[model samples]
Target: MMSCSNERQIITNAGFLAVVASQATAGFLSAIFSIIVLRKCGNLHVHQNCKILIVSMVMLYIVHSVSITILQTTQLIRYLTYYDPCVVGLSTVICFCLRLPASVCTTSFASLLFAIVFERATALWKRGKYDAYGPQLGYALVTISIIVSLASTFWAVQKVEFDQHSVYCSTATSQTADRVMLLCFLISGVNIITLVGIIALFIFNEFALSRREFDLQSSYQLRENAYVIRIMLPLSIFQAICYAIFSISSGLISLFRDKLSPVQHKTLYTTAY
Candidate 1:
């Protein structure tokens, strides 16, 4: 059994390294794109909202990179310490350090995405009416989301505790924490769906307008709307793909953890990384 555990630990370490590499690459790309957008869109008042979203995404990527690094390292430690009691305490500490930051960043990203999508939807459906209240409503929503995220983090910290002897220290027994996590994921998914739908509607509307005899200004507005979709479409796709990869990997790891031997567990973890 001990030999099997040792073998698994080796595999898990390799997986952790892979996750670190992927995350680093993604973070770098996100940061570069964000800088480019900020530089190129400086004079475009029309793209001001998009610029804010881009900045928010950049911030999310930064936090995600740091938190994932800590989480992966701690997971590696947990795997390696299956037979070594001395290292478990350090592993637990690393996990504790990572969890809150990861949750906070995830929550913030979800909130920003929701705001961006909701605002775009309203703009599309109500047309000029959105202009009247968009900024104020967006600000209020973001503020509320942040407050909720912070409060949830505090509550989670109070309810969750480390197990000195176990590798998995998550407070899965806490119903409230689980519910809060579920709510966050639900909100994120809804936001993504809403944004995708709005983008589609905008594209269709632009096509319809192009076929009709519209005023010059109205035609220009349609063109601008199409341009926004072009930029946002790629970003939305990237985010969706990232989320899907993470979710699938996490689900498989959890589902197979109990059935596999220690070495297999480590191998799976490494592959996931």
Candidate 2:
């Protein structure tokens, strides 16, 4: 004997609960996988680096998933007439908590990928000199990544203002946010190009190394490097595409905010989450 509004409210609550539960589960699983990778790959230097990268990616995804869940749940509650300003406020806070860490982790991952590429290039092209500068390059790349990520965080916070009335939780005024989103898309495109270029170089170096009278171990290592490049290249490309799509969609939403109807707003917010 429930009323129509009551039924809609029940459905909204159920949907929101489901999203939050899924997010929590995903975060838990990611944490467990990160721990396992760290434990199993602790001894080998190469594997240790790989583990660090994997852990960083998992943590980033965990933050994203949790943020989406909070946003969705908050929207659902708001829609179901159980809206509380404080709940909305908390959701915004949680969204930001995830955003900053995710950005930093992504930057760190890109730097790691760049370092690995440089190391491989050095080993193949300047074998005798690699040991002299490989560690130094790695250290420099990681440090630079940290600094860049911090700078980006400061810029985003300063330039973007959170929209309290909008369902989506983000920093930046609508117009400025659109520009920032475009910049992110451009960055992703550049990343994809860089990854592809590195992969091409890797393949060429592998071919050259194979035909030379190099040490057997060196040849084997070159092949391994080629394999890693193959895997990472595709992954990087996929991530770039994902980032581009997200950025473009966000930019469009921000640009058309005033023209969108309530249903359109809800749909867009849901898609974003």
Instruction: State which candidate has the highest TM-score.
Output: 2
What's the lDDT for residue 174 in model 1?
A: 35
**lDDT tens per residue, model 2, 43-109:** 5334233334444444545554454445445544554554443333234345566456645555555
Model 1: residues with Cα > 4 Å off, grouped in runs: 1-47, 69-85, 88-94, 129-134, 145-159, 163-188, 211-221, 266-273
- All candidates' lDDT scores? 0.55, 0.54
The per-residue C-alpha lDDT of model 2 at residue 178 equals 48
Q: Give the distance in Å from residue 18's predicted Cα in candidate 1 to where it truly belongs.
A: 4.6
List per-candidate RMSD values in Å. Answer: 5.1, 5.7
How well does candidate 1 score on lDDT at residue 120? 55
What's model 1's lDDT at 170?
A: 35
Please give each candidate's TM-score: 0.67, 0.70
For model 1, the local distance difference test gives 0.55
Residue-wise C-alpha lDDT for candidate 1, range 41-140, written one tens digit per residue: 5655443454465456566656766566555555555555446533443344445566667666666665666566655555455443433443555556
TM match of model 2 to true structure: 0.70
